[model samples]
Target: MVGDYDSYFADRARRGAETSPTSATTEPAKTAPAKPRNAPKSGLTYKETRELETLEKTIAETERKIADIETLFSDPEFYRTRAAEAAPLQKELESLKTGLDDAYARWGELEDKKSGS
Candidate 1:
């Protein structure tokens, strides 16, 4: 009886091995189609676009001021004569940066709302 059972299992195993592909060389199964790459039809409204543009311009101006301050601080003569002059510009730049950050956060919130997130 044990021998008969062993032969029965061996036959079942052989059948299973034959039905399944043994080699990894077989082509992979087909995948689902990819999602479209285009952005959704929805986008920023005209007012939001204008606000973003304004914020971007202000940020650019602030960046220019920071660059000028850095250059002035690097020059020994300017540091001695005009370090005080750069202080207010530096403070204004910091305030602009904070405003820029707030504007960006607001933009993100608006985008999420528009996207129905």
Candidate 2:
């Protein structure tokens, strides 16, 4: 699980670097041939970039909420005392899992498009 999360973040960092302006070093920055104003280095259109950002936000938030719920479920005392509450939380966890799956699928599609796969 940690590997999955780490890979996601590493991929995000790589994509972010691709989209950002080139950093200047001690030497003068060499200018590359200019691309069209609308063309980003990542090869995603502006709309697709926006969609990716939104999807990333949703995925991160959903993962966080799922982790919180999982932590709650892991506590035996909480479960023993609040078995009734567990059913609603279980439903919520399933719902969140579904949404996370969808978000990941969409993310993969966008990534594939970006990679020209």
Candidate 3:
């Protein structure tokens, strides 16, 4: 009786259903696209880019000078002969340090404006 009942229901379901072909399936809906993992855009203009490049080059050159000064300071003979070396490098480093501070302040101002703060 159970076998007859099961077969009867199965046959009835198959007969009642309309036979149709399945279409290609698709993935479930997603929330949103992934964001890029990078530093936020500064929205700097062309002039800003040129200024930054110039400042960065100056800073790099100053840093190299500082490194050379340090090397000279380490050597007794060079330290005596190049006593004048440290003064200029120190002055340039201080100037570059001020430039970096100004750049950071400008960047902060830009960021604040962008955030509507």
lDDT of each: 0.74, 0.90, 0.66
- What are the candidates' C-alpha RMSDs? 10.7, 26.3, 11.6
Residue 50 alpha-carbon offset, candidate 1, angstroms? 1.7
**Stretches of candidate 1 exceeding 4 Å from the true structure:** 1-42, 110-117
Off-target runs (Cα >4 Å) in candidate 2 are 1-42
Q: For residues 9-43, write the lDDT of model 3, one tens digit per residue.
A: 99777765644223224455777988879965656
| Candidates, ranked, lDDT | 2, 1, 3
For TM-score, the strongest prediction is: 2
Q: In angstroms, how far off is 10's CA in candidate 1?
A: 77
Q: Candidate 1, which ten residues in sequence have the lowest lDDT sum? A: 19-28
Of 2 and 3, the candidate ahead on TM-score is: 2
- Predicted structure with the largest lDDT when compared to the true one: 2
Judged by whole-model lDDT over C-alpha atoms, candidate 3 comes out at 0.66
C-alpha TM-scores of all predictions? 0.46, 0.60, 0.39
| lDDT of prediction 2 | 0.90
lDDT of 1 by residue, 40-91 (tens): 5566788877876786677677667667767776789986777677778678
